[model samples]
Target: MATVPFPFSPVSCAFSRQTGIRRSPLVLALLSSSALLFPVQVHAQQANAGAEATELTEIVVEGATDSASGPDKSIVAGRTLAGSKTDTAVEDISASVSVITQAEMERRGTQNLDEVLAYTSSVSADEYGSDDRYDWVRIRGFYQTSTGSYLDGLPMRISGFTGSRVEPYGLQRVEVLKGSTSTLFGLNAPGGLINSISKRPQAVKHGEVYTTLGDEHVEFGTDFGGPIDDQGIWSYRITSKWQDGNNGADHTEDDRFYIAPALTWAPTDATSLTLLPSYNKRDGNTAHGIPYGSGIDPKTYLGEPEFEAMDTIEKNIGYAFSHDFGNGLQFRQNARYTDLDLTYESVYGATADPSVSRSAWAVYGNSRRFVIDNQLQYDVSFGRFDSRSLAGMDFSYNDTDEHRVFGSASGINIYNPVYCGLSCLTLPAGYDWNQQETARGFYLQEELTFDDRWILTLGGRFDSVTTESAFPDSGLSYKADDEAFTKRIGLTYKVTDGLSVYGNYSESFQPISADRTSLVGTPKPQEGTQYEVGLKYRPANYDALFTLALFDLTQTNVPYNISTTTQSQIGETNVKGVELEGKFALTDQFNLTVAYSYWDAEIVEDGITGNQGNKPQLIPQQMASIWADYTLPGEGIFGDLTLGLGVRYTGASFADNENTLKIKPHTLVDAAVNYQIRDNVALAVNATNLFDTEYLSYVSIYDNTAFYGDGRAVRATLKYTW
Candidate 1:
């Protein structure tokens, strides 16, 4: 967790909680409204800080033309808006963006966001081979949990039993916007999106504090920030962490606690405002796959170590605002509110027989969400052309309440036995229904730039959604609504100053579920379209960034389920891809990152004629990865060293859909090291499948289960900084 150089525009804020020591009345009204808005924003920043800094100093010099990394400071970034929400660059963005920073997650000691997108490219995070409790990714080949995910750019309300668990050291970067963004993010998942960002408030001061210990884990963390005075116009940050471990499966337990806090105030300098709060909790254990030629032992535990566990808690509070109204126009707003809670009980051992029978379940969930967005940007011109425009609106609401209780425990011995206890399973005296959803959107965009080497982009969006349900033990109620409109277009051609060439076309929509009407009729609305072409290279010398992309997407009305309450929008799917990425530093001590992807996802139209052209289970028609790091060059106590290495690959697919359960291909290797025992301490070590590779990270085929992929774990860290 390291960061600095933050001058606003990381738009978004969020957190709240209380349980055993008070707090939580919405975290005491968000800590009494941030202590009554912190002295009224420091008395309105000392009463208008000198007539708003002399009339906003020409609107801060026209907001420095929306600075797109003009004064180069590197961690590999040439500006971004996750591919055009404004701040362009990223080689003019025609698509396929991927950023990851915080110094590449502290030189790959990444811990989640699926190990910070293990080598990126078409991504395929935690493909379930262990490490459960959320964050399962998949991009170019679909399944981004739900609607692709986001944070600094809003949208992070998932459901099944609620979701969203971040804390990758409270992130400071992590983009990955790869295809069909629903024209400025409306209903998504054409395999793209994963924003994150957050880790704001900075005016120089920095910090870090860490502790981690391996093979069964243990953790502690802190990340600090600066200024609240000295007139840096108030700034602050805080990111916390605490963890307890054991994820080598057996008797699994993995606890956690996280916190995030932020603040910013800039009373002038064209205004700014920020505030964020967060809290997270977890106590994990869940993910009992196993039953693929079950020779058992993938860290076999088969559940039941005194009634297993999987608790959760989440809370967030947010804010983000911008101002700058000096002739170039600008106004922004962001919001957040979230709450989630879940409890799960387990009892697996689903197969390996023993007269087969061992499955108990329990889940009680709750969720609440509220989101918001508002934007308006301008930056116009005419005379050798130049422009940047945007308009926006967004809203979201959510409510989910769940309940499930099933029983039938006791059935051990896959090699060993276990004794039952929770009264041998039996729990159900209440709860079973609730759901609510709401959404809204309106978007517009335009980017245009001509003489400076052509760049054009267009966008559009309009959306509406609603969902409601209730069934308190069968008292029934339901509702639905829908609407959509999406579009996007792009073109780029810088062809110089570090290359660029691009093209794009996009659209996406998702609606359906209007009171669930479909037995082959009335529930239309999924939709997608894409076409892309790309090339970007930021070489000139080094500090690197490279890319190449080609794509074709397609999706349409997909829905299936034919009975038990009917569903059937028939189906359709397609994907065609290619991607290559690179991130290098090639010198100041070497660094590198590479990624590759292929993807061919099929199922082009199907109502079930043998699943029409199949090939879409776990998507992976190739993937690749590489990573490297180096540093060495000592002085004093022989310290200051660094090293890292990585490798990954995936291919092979079809775990069913009658594509005949094939699942093979695998590769893995990872390592790391760090030392620098003075200058504020350091010492690190990391490893992941450094050989104990077993493979099959996920394969279900309707619960014929599989999951394995995490072995040779190791960790060791100790850091302290200023």
Candidate 2:
């Protein structure tokens, strides 16, 4: 295909600063007061960007060789760039955004977000996605949750312990941005973030469904889609899933179910809109780490499962909306109303001593949250200079209403350890609690790109939050806090055709309610600053990209205690690190992606050890992964067969910041095979932890304190697409 470049001139919101034509002095609702909006721009491309247009491609999940079946290629459909607001190539975005294509998930038989990310370098998710309890992926060592997530540029979540599980079948792609992102974005954690582009109306008819299985009793899931119109203006997609499974080492079980629906509207050639409404219900046990004491050999439990002694449940409903007003103008609104009835109780040593583990009291609670967000933006033009600016406000008020219900029974009757297997009985009862926490925030951001080759970004935000507790007739105990404004700025320069260089400066402020007063003390805001430099390279001739980065960051004012524990420098620390990533299509039928990272963190100014040195618990100093697939086209009655392989390596880590406990590094591998049966149907098989490796995610004992990684297992999937 000859390169077709639709290059345009640079236009910006610059003169507006003096003319004040479209912006107001007061940013009414957005938590921030500034935003960078890019409403218009020109053409883009290249391997090394030598004037050749890049080929657009989609991943194959059904293992089909025909690259003709993808959302973007549909006769009638719109597109999105969730990683950036402008035409910035993925390799030039400054921030690292890991792209998880829909094909990648289907190819791996992924049932959850964690499964798809397992093979991604720089990403480590909770071992299983069987339920909502521990399905989180860590990027650069920070947990990616509601605080680190977005759907079509709108906030997708709000808390960590309680984040939403997006079904793999309902997304066009998953983009992960590493490092501080206070610019062009609002209130967020400095640990990095994830953006999920929802599946929308395709203006055409299209859809598919696939089911999978594995060890630990794992089973059930399907994803399907289609059009809702003939004028090519609307479309709809649905995803549903359920499973009963077990994680390795503790006799554990993963069980849960969920579903989601979405609608897309494209009224004309220059504009588009999307709406998504989702609901999920999950119930399952958590990872059973060995008790604090009573040393036991982790080897003896290698085949054991993390027992389901503890249980939990969750329910949520939410809607997301996004509109692109051609010419660099856009807007978004997200709202959610959630009511949860849950009960959590842990039997300390269910496997070691069922009686003692079961005897522990269970704590139960019910929680409710309501959140709404609105943001607006417009892109303008300037004669010699062009800038993408955004000015909008967001108000998120979470009324976390929680109350304790009662306590549950302990593990008893099974005094002999022999009964600890799946045969164990007489599990303990559960309990609940009642409490409430409220938080509100406002923010804004702005970005400027010169000649479409250089970008500068700036932004800030403020927040107010409170927490309260109520136990039956004891009235209530409440605490409130306010934080200072946080700021961030960044720069990116196109160094070569497919590569760019970038640097950033950012700050994060946290407000905690430890003072028991309206605003007694703010704990100095846990101030932090970072210095980083990186290279993003996407070869001009092939479908491949490589990235290298280094950074130094420091954090202070971390709380030391739960109540009245808001102290400054009690846990001050410094972190420095390096990272590398690459994605490429080896051939017309083969593709591969790889990533690696190294980090060094320590307490620089803390009470624990004046200047104690130790890596964060469960945080490996080194991590790497590779995923590749090969397919044979136009072959047998079975059709093209695609094979996939993945491997991961994790470095040493400690169980606590004190460095009292330690764990050595380990490696694991996975495999998969896919074959087409008919023009619209395909079959697949997937296996993880093929070797059933035994390694501890963290230290639990002197001789045997590690947890199991995963045991070997397999499942077959049948999928049909139109």
Could you tell me which residue pairs clash in candidate 1? 13-318, 14-277, 14-317, 15-277, 15-278, 15-316, 15-317
Summing lDDT over every window of 10 consecutive residues in candidate 2, give the lowest-scoring window.
11-20
**Candidate 2 lDDT over residue span 1-722, tens digit each:** 00111110000000000000112112111102111110110122213346643232323332222121123221111122443443345655556666666656666767667776775556657531222344455666654454566655555443313333555656666667676654445444555667776565454455666566555565565656555666767767676767776554345555667677766666775555555666565555543444334455442322123333334444545555557777778776666666554444333333344544332323344446666666666677686556666555555444333332222234433223343444433443322224454556566667677877787867666665554544435554544455567677778888776678998777654443334343224344445566778887766655566678888766665544323433333556566777776665545566666667666666554443332555555566666676667776744444777888877766666655556666666777888888777777778898876787766564333222234454566778777776
lDDT of each: 0.73, 0.53
What is the RMSD of candidate 2?
Answer: 12.8
Global fold similarity of model 2 (TM-score) = 0.79
Q: How close is candidate 1 to the true structure, as a TM-score?
A: 0.33
